[model samples]
Target chain A: MIIDVSDPADPRLADFVGLRDAQLRRSEDRFIAEGLKIIERAFAAGAPPRSLLLQPRWLDGVLPLLTRFPDVPVYVGTEAMIEEVSGFHVHRGALGSFDRPAEATWEALLGARRLLVCEEIVDHANIGAIMRVAAGLGWDGVLVSPGSADPLYRRAIKSSMGASLELPWRRMGGAADLARLREAGFTVVASTISPRAVDVDAFEAPEKVALLLGTEGAGLSREWLAAAGAHVRIPMTDRVDSLNVATAAAILAHSLRQRG
Target chain B: MIIDVSDPADPRLADFVGLRDAQLRRSEDRFIAEGLKIIERAFAAGAPPRSLLLQPRWLDGVLPLLTRFPDVPVYVGTEAMIEEVSGFHVHRGALGSFDRPAEATWEALLGARRLLVCEEIVDHANIGAIMRVAAGLGWDGVLVSPGSADPLYRRAIKSSMGASLELPWRRMGGAADLARLREAGFTVVASTISPRAVDVDAFEAPEKVALLLGTEGAGLSREWLAAAGAHVRIPMTDRVDSLNVATAAAILAHSLRQRG
Candidate 1:
């Protein structure tokens, strides 16, 4: 299972090609786990390894993770060759290909007391950071709008520090799912910058709450804001209009946590 | 002031040469404001305009800002030439060179009730985002360790939506300044991941606060933490060790805000 590869054109290394070329769709069956820590996280998440391309120095560190998958190919290459295969420099000289984890079900998300629903948040890093905050703060689940970025993309996973793999999340089939979540007895709160919105802290937290966020440049759309049962704004000075969506998410997640 | 420049090598245009080059120092007297919106923000800040390199298509929009500084040269170029000079694709065909605003004095920072103290948080984007959150949430001033990234760096300015130019900030001469801030009647609070730290919400918000942030990778050093009057942490599940430093700053800044 340990194969040495000097040729960058080896078909076995296809999983890493054009990773930084900006052409590959990130929603493929396999997702990349870059760097040493994430590779370990992938195995810990019970991800099925497709292959691992690394250098000789990294072989021992990866051996423990591969004990269960002795048949899985472990490709070794010089640092230069590995860089040539992957579009960018592989951090710590490791790249992992693992089958993407299955999305969590709607019924599963409904079990949590606190959840985050992203409305068209398209940046991979923001999506990943939101997941990191959601998971770290003990939020039960995350739901992404249909147009959201793939959380399994390598950069997103890296930004989340691998929390995207552990967090229970799913892409909503459509916007109507917002109403469906409300029908399930969850208070859907939309974050906005509108003047009439109540201060975030002044609004009381309910037993089951779903906090909604929006994209980077423009905030929650008119249609989405009107759909929510309540609108809350982070009180701020007039000098700056809004915080980064991810930063806003962290603030809201921390503010609205259920006290023990 | 409208000068036609076909040569990218023109000495008068040295302010913008290799703008995107990694090797260039960004702490110069003039900071770049890329994109039309930031360029307009720079003008709105009453920032002194050194020059503007923009395409002819953007001329009409920029004309209003240049009327007061008729002597400031306006270099006109094709989109291709602008990219060649700046070392990257110029976002929407505009880059402005504005004289850096002066840092705020110690007296000015102490005059405010709430302040942010950053210790070696050197990433340009994080510095910018911190400033944006600080400005948005009505925080008074910011103090950074001498090693922090220049908030006026082009990317930082752009990331802060030009709040870096508007926010009051300065670098501390030494870590002793923490004690100085405390002596000035500020409650210096250090953020950390240590489990023994008090939960952020449980801590009382003093009349005056100096929320201390740590470096990007490894957090606040031992010396700085010992100097802080209080230690607070955002309560979280044991999944991730810590949130991104900027995200942590936003949550703490929001959580510990004076309720007045």
Candidate 2:
């Protein structure tokens, strides 16, 4: 279904408004991915598009993508209309709306030996980086805490190089949800800078392990650390205190996977 | 000396132009640290300010800072002039220009058991984050390879929470520098994603160790790996290939420090 609309206020374009809001919600449910390269990667990775909105100039470039998702609707609008619809300047030439993938269950995500459980990491870019690392390093999946930023936010998707769409991940409401992992034989390792924390290297990878990280400012809440099977600290120089949460998570993920 | 310059074209303010350009350079001889709090922290850390440039409204707010650095020139400019001089609008109310600190020698930087050797990691934010982690975790210092971005770049410094100014660090010219480290009894561990690389946790941290990190996209170069005493990888799942370089570096630093 190819529909041509010249108006920016078209009701069909509601999915792409105020992307920053979606980031705060911890869900990409109402977000859209822009650009041909990103959309193609998502499609190649088996992500189905809900619809395609594009300018006439992009038709030639987008026709090839349309062939893949034959049933997906393609909406054509003027450049001026798209600018108004997106509520910002977007010169990406093409955009696509896709339904957020179903949330993965703890069992589904924990099937792999190495996992990351993000605690209150609210930055979209950091979430994206974590997903990229997770996908790049072959981590099974990421379990994002409730307060963490949405991985599907436009900036995050862009930062992840589309890996947020490809990586296996799920969101947990809070620390209580994490308890189930331990019952399922996953050793929860909380990464912190506390004095009593064990060296990250000291932990031998168990049959299954979950690396927990929090925001850089406050670090992991004491409750989360107390619940962990072990508190892990990355050693550092006396002058510096902590690594960014995403960076620390990646290192720990890599370490755990190596041990496994 | 207090110089009141009504004109924005004064040549004395040349160092503050195109602040963004500082990040592109191989080395920034000087950079601005904005915000009163960060400037205070830098001063407390013994980083001398080269000059204090401020708006009239902030004159009283910054008078105390000037007392500590009587030798440093203090420039008061009108709000319009300061904005024009900075090229971009800054709302921090004041800015301080600081000369880049003298580079530390490899021996001085490697005084501790653990050190960070960043090889060509160009992102300023990543460099800053690494510095912050290095400082927070009590690492000795950072050694930057020739191609790496300057740690003193404005954004880098800000992202580091001003720790970049306080951290003991040096810049090595090339592979020969690694050779020098080896001769100095520092074990060089290059981080890569190669299947054959030993797990990061398994790599022993010698009394003196330099963890080598490469640019984010390409893992450690072959020459670097060959030159390194050991090639280590953060274990990750099959889907995720790597972590952000800075994150990887921090994890490595923390791990080495913990073991030490």
Candidate 3:
């Protein structure tokens, strides 16, 4: 059913408002994915949208998809109403909210030989890029630290080219969760550019390895690095300091996966 | 001396105008690097700024640097004037223009054991990120194909965390450049995800190697791949496809540098 919402203040659209704050609170473990192409890919990948909001003009293109999920509501609104309701420009003409998948267990994620563990990576774009890399390089799954940005954040989902939706991922509560990963027989490898760290290539790949990446600015914290099984550094020129966290994660993921 | 001008149309600030167009035209070969931090880093790295333009209010803070380059013209203007002159908001509080460095020859770039060769990657941010990765991963320089975006583009420089200024790079004029690089004894390894390509880890480090990267969407052209000494791929899982071009380059650059 197409419900037209002329009022911007309609409580029905509350799911999409103040998303960043909602994400911080963990009250809304959901995110909006924009654009028809990405939404279609998400649906095709078996990830169903919890709800959808679209301009009347897009109904013709979206109606066919709605047929696949009869129970889900397709909220229709005027362009002006969506812009006001979204509190941002909705230039993509369509948006959909999807629930974050249930957290995958460590057993499922660490089953593969290679994986990525994002430690306190707060930026949505970086998280998205890391997901894209993880998927592109064939890493098993991603483990997000408690403070990391939600992989399902609207911007991250868009930035990942919707790969985040397709990729398997889970969040670790904190250091305790990381401890569980360590106990699970996974070799936790921390990436840092510090002199004390062995060159990344020198680190032998184990049967199960988790590549830990931190934020772009400060890199992995000492506490976290000390907790890891090994600290690895990407060999760099003296003039060049470091790679973006996402890029660093990609390199490590590619290297670890290729070790087989 | 700091010359103040309230008029936005002052001909002295021509180099700082319409930066969007300036970013696209290699013939003009001009790009803007905003913010005091990036501009200062560029200057400290020996990439001289051709001119400095700043808000008159910031004269006190920027004056010391301005004094160091007496020969370089320093144009001071009101925030409103700077915005009008540049056709964009001047949020960085300062902007500077620099002369494009002389293009490095293929031989000059390959002298180092490792280098990055970009083939038609048009996004400025990707170009910038690749440059940062190349530098951080101990690669000597970068070579761009004709169709690639200029590394000097404003956004590219910012994305690179200002490493674009510190790295040596040049644009390849034609196939002849690749031919010359081949003749110079640099092993050109093209990165791909094709079924038949050897896993990226298989390539032993040569004395001099040029890791060739292509646009993310289509990947390296068949002709380019055929011309390369070997085709290498970053192994990925069945569900995941490919990584972003810059991230992929970072992985490949790190691997090659580590091997060396």
Candidate 4:
């Protein structure tokens, strides 16, 4: 249903309020998809939209997608109203409130051949970029540690360019989960900068592999590093110590990806 | 020299005012380096420090580095005062104003073996990440198009982990510079998603290589692509359209980096 809303404080626009406030968004089960492209991606991924608030200009572009769910409300408002409600200039004046999908099951991830396991990666943008590269390179799924950033967060979704909507991922329980990956016939490899770590190029990809990435500053925790079956490091000049987590993810994902 | 300034508007603090204002900073012949780490990197790179504005709490940590530049003024102030002057919460209450070094001469870059050529990548953080990866992977230098973001910008330098301070880079006059690179015996390879582009893994690296990267939203411009001696692409599944420019740079830099 299409509903025209004039007041920024209208209770109908509650889903769109305080969009820029991360803490407020975190407590809710719903996630916001920004811009027309990501909204379309969310729709294509079969995410159910609770409501949409967009300018009249975008109505025609979004009409076709709304056909699937005739009951979901589409709140039409002015760009100024959206900025007022959301506390930020809504990108292209389009935003979709969607029920965050349930994360992939551990069984589903274990059955996959390639998986990126992130440990305490707290940056939303970094996690999003990791998901984008992981999906682009055809990795089967991803497992983020309990302390990692939410891939479904707006900034993360935007950074992933909507890959978070398509990629199969779940929040891992804890460090003990490394044993579960190994038990499922996957070689757990830690990406670290330790001097004794095997060079990425020199390290052979096992038939099934789970690449472990760590937090931005500290890298993988010592407990997580010790649990891995193998440790791999990207060779680099001593001039710099490490690559950004996402940048390292791309290079490692490309180099160690399962080949036909 | 130590100066304790109470007022944010002190003329002596002019070099540090409006540090968050990019436009104001762009027109000057100097750049701000944030945090003690980046400030140290700037010092290690031998960039002359014009002045230092930092909290008194960090005085002991910065004292050792100042011994070398005894003539440089070190202004001690409260974090609130530094924040008031810089227009942002200065990271760790440490900031340095340094003379932006001169661009590396064309002669210096032309002699390098492995070079990353950026084409209008206007995001400061993206350019910074590109520089960080290029430096980490041992690329000899970088060549940015006339329209690319300033690699010396504070955000760029911080995103690069100070690689922008150490990596030798220069802006090209225009597309005609590609010919100069070719003349220097470097293969001008464009990183494109064009269907006909050779898979990066399959393409053999030339003796000397200059890999071209494009802007964020759009890929490489046609004129630049047409002028390239070769086109290469990282093979990826069709799920995502392309990798982030910085992510692409890291993979390409690693795969095609000059090796013994």
Q: Which prediction has the highest lDDT against the true structure?
A: 4
Q: lDDT of model 3 at residue B124? A: 88
Candidate 4 lDDT over residue span B79-124, tens digit each: 8998899888776789999999998999999999999999999889
lDDT of 3 by residue, A91-176 (tens): 88798877666766767876666678888888889999888888877777888988898887777887788888887899887876
Which residue pairs of candidate 1 clash?
none
Give per-residue CA lDDT, model 1, range B87-155, as digits (tens). 888878988998888899999998788899999988888989999988988888889898887788888
Please tell me the TM-score of chain A for candidate 1: 0.95
Worst 10 residues of 4 chain B by lDDT: B18-27
lDDT per residue (tens digit) for residues A159-186 in model 4 = 9999999999998889989999999999
Judge candidate 3 at residue B31 and give its lDDT: 55
Q: Write the per-residue lDDT of candidate 2 for residues A54-142, one digit (tens) a residue.
A: 88777777678778667877889877777777766677868888877776776687666778889988888989988887786667788
| lDDT (tens digit, per residue) of candidate 1 on A1-260 | 89999999999899988787422646578899988899998999899999999999999899999999999999999989999998788868999999988899888888778999999888889999998999888898899998888888888899899999999999998788988888888999998887899988889999999998998669878778888999988877888767889898888888888887
Model 4 lDDT at residue B79: 85
Superposed model 3: Cα runs more than 4 Å off: A2-12, A18-26, A55-61, A71-84, A106-114, A258-260, B3-7, B22-25, B55-61, B71-81, B89-91, B110-113, B258-260
Show pairs that collide, candidate 3.
Answer: A137-B236, A138-B236, A138-B237
Candidate 4: CAPRI quality band = high
Separate DockQ for every predicted complex: 0.79, 0.50, 0.64, 0.83
Measured over all alpha carbons after superposition, the RMSD of each candidate to the real structure, in angstroms, is: 2.2, 4.3, 3.1, 2.2
| Residue A55 of model 3, lDDT score | 90
TM-score of 4: 0.94
User: What lDDT, from 0 to 1, does candidate 1 have?
Assistant: 0.88
Candidate 4, number of clashes:
0
TM-score of each: 0.94, 0.81, 0.88, 0.94
lDDT tens digits, residue span B213-249, model 2: 8887787788888899888876655553456676777
